[model samples]
Target: MARTRPRPRPVATGCLMGRLRGNPWAILCVLSLAYFMAQLDISVLTVAVPDITRDLHTSFDRVAWALGSYVLALAVTLITAGRLGDLYGRRRVFRAGVVLFTLSSLVAGLTTTVDQLIAARALQGLGAALLIPQTMALLVEAFPVARRGTALGVRGTVGAAAAVVGPLVSGLLVTVLDWRWVFFVNVPVGTALLLATVLVPDDDRAPGPARLDVVGTLLVSVSLFCFAFAVSQGERYGWRGWFWGLVALSAVAFAVFLRQQRRRQSGDPLVPFELFRDRDYALMNVVSVCVSLAFMGLVLVLSVFFQSVLAFSALKAGLAIVPAALCSMVFGTVAGRLSDRLPAKYLLLAGTGLTVAGMLWTAAGMHEGADWPRFVAPLSVIGVGNAFLFTPLAAVGLRGLRPELAGAASGVLVTTLQIGSMIGTALSGALLGGGAGSGPTAASSRSAMVLFAVVAALAAPACAASSRTPRAGGTGDRAPDEDAGRAAAGRSPCREPRPSGPGRGQGGVPR
Candidate 1:
């Protein structure tokens, strides 16, 4: 007897999802919510930190592992997962990630000990790593060059919403219910997202032939794990010899990774180093890292200041920042529309300048006690600034990347943001000494603001540097006559091709 071939479930699922094919906006809705879940998980857990420590009878130092494990695991595996998506299929891997993340959330919520929670968190991170980049890659493939900015802006807004929701929801849950509810909350959201995902057609793999470089993947994964672990744990462990050693290993392993990638003359390399040759792309990455560094530190300080200085309850503190979140949502759409008309350089400059102002304003509030009403203005300003910065930056990163490289580029871009977040959090914690209520907390917040401002200020020069690129790549400045494959006029890979004749296989219709 002939062996039976397994019929894929998504074939049926895809038919169910086929209604969403021409509706790119609806597809984006699914992607945005999924991305929001991944982003929200990190901040939500932070709110429950104290409760987790007390309930599990774990030391404050040990419970830190819950956060660290997740961050490290997410960072280390992103690149490999991205390439694998290119090699196999994004739809399958992304669905797998959703299942893993939801199950892990269940495990995390049920755990009685810190170790169990930490292990479950690590699995959650791995799931997150697999899905996040695929979201961006699918975004790039799904949207046309003309409207990509608007979609990216929507994604930016979703991220901002995650920040706003994470604290508020977590605070309420930890206060009114058990700390485990933070994990439990994901169950419903993840289920809804998974169902929505099944209703959308799984994106086809990248157009060109691709192959996975196993050695390259291993090297980079090891390097990233070492680097991410070192940064996440450095402050807690006191920068001891082991800490420095891990950092050193990260550097060495990364060097080996580069060598391995360079040696792959035929196969698909984990990272196409050639992408950096585009000046606009390189500068965008630089600005992304710096902006993320400042944003992370600024957010950490404000959250601490509101509760510690103003004596507001956790829920109140979270609600106080609502103005910023609202502003970001309203203006982010405006900025996305503007991106299609304005040069990206100007928006980047405006964003950084606004961010600096917001940071200074928040720092000012920390002086002589918290200025309750005063902080709202700056928070709103930061929201608008973030809207301007992120979407255009995403457009810049996607510029000139062929469809085949979308996943890899998305991975690299998000990885830069992750590293910056880790560094900024650690640096801000160091600056604040005891985080929120120390004798120098107010003064430290000011100093940290200045440090972040200086970093934000640096993006101006990089923005200037970016303008030197040929038409600035796709910064709403590319010439019409440039290579069609790399510009706005290029065909999107996600669109189904037209059938050439009657009864053709394209749409599977008989004449």
Candidate 2:
């Protein structure tokens, strides 16, 4: 007797959740909230550092691990987590992550020692890594190609808002309630996310049995940890020889990992090389790093400038930057919509140019006596620029990728951005005269901003290169892989193909 396949559950029937289930917009809302919660944790703990140190009787340096460990774990595990989503279902992996993150937040809230808090934070980071990649991959699968940009744009807006709002929220929580509430806040959010998981489509996984690249995972994880450790701790540790040694170890391990991937590309590699074959995808990776580094470095410097130099409270400083974040939220969605109609490269160029201008303007205007109000314009310009760049960046980067590879591609893209942010933090700290705790002088802040402007400017050429190939707007254009397959079949991939039938087009959709 032949085995019968089990029927998949119907998601869009029965009760209220069932009615909303499998709806692309509903999934987008759920995914966006998950991303927001994860991104919020990245910066929220900083404002609670003082209270945490006081309550736990720990030194500032030790308390710093609460932030560092979270970031480190997130960065290192992202690649593996992405691949896992490909093997397992994205919704399954995402729900598991939400569960871990929620439980970890509870543990973190109840922790009596700083060490326990650090452990909980690391777990939270791991949880974030698992869910974040799935958010992108699932978005790709849930929405059609035409509507994907709008969805991603909305998600980007939420993530940007979360990052900016975290400080203010932390301050409010710590002030009125306690520092413990910082972690406790995530409990309700996480629970909501888990409950909403049922709304997500259950078919968001690659169809295959694939092996996890254990060796590659270990190698890349070690490399990322070493590199992150060196970058984040170099200034704190006085740039010691051991720090440089770790950097070298990271480099060597990465080289080995690349070799392993090359050998295993025919099998189940953690990162599929085919994703990089498209010029836009490869160039976008560079663009991702540059944009991340520029934005994060400037934020670090300006945050310190607002608080330490200008004597603004953490909440006030967060409020000062609210204009930019608000602009990012508005313009990012617009840019995403525009990307579906226009080439994303032009927006990237305009965005980077504006960011460079805004950084310089803010830098020049930043004086010791200047209040936070003085930065509203320049910061707003930077925010608008960020909205444009980040919103369309993902759309263009993943445009030509195969659906099966979306999870891995999302992982690689996010990892570059994370590493870039870490680097920016290290660079900003060095330029700010050691760390944010030290009162950064006006001159140092200006110099740091200038450095960020220069970094932002570097993205222009990469952006230009990323879009030389025509986009898949109509029957005339095809995805890179399809074009490659056509070329291999001895046909001109660039030549427009005749419509398949009446009211049907090249991609097999009815007009």
Each candidate: what lDDT? 0.75, 0.84
Off by over 4 Å in 1: 1-18, 206-209, 435-440, 467-511
Per-candidate RMSD, Å: 5.9, 5.9
In candidate 2, what are the lDDT values of residues 322-438, reduced to their tens digit? 888899998888888887787778888999999899999999898879987789999999989888888887777887776667788889998998999899999988998874466
In order of appearance, the predictions have TM-scores of 0.87, 0.90
Q: List the residue pairs that clash in candidate 2.
A: none
Could you give candidate 1's per-residue lDDT for residues 1-511 as a string of tens digits?
1122332333222353453443456668888888889888877887888899999998988788998888888888888887766666676677878888899999999999999999999999999988888887777655666677788878877776676668887988998999999999888988888887754455554444556778888888889988888887887666789988999999999998888888874556888886676677778789878988888887777777677656677888888877777887888888887876777678778887887888777676677565568788988888888777776787766766566566777788888888888898888777777534444356777788888878878888887766522344342333445444433534323233222122333221122
Distance from true location, Cα of 386 in model 1, Å: 0.9
Clashes of each: 1, 0
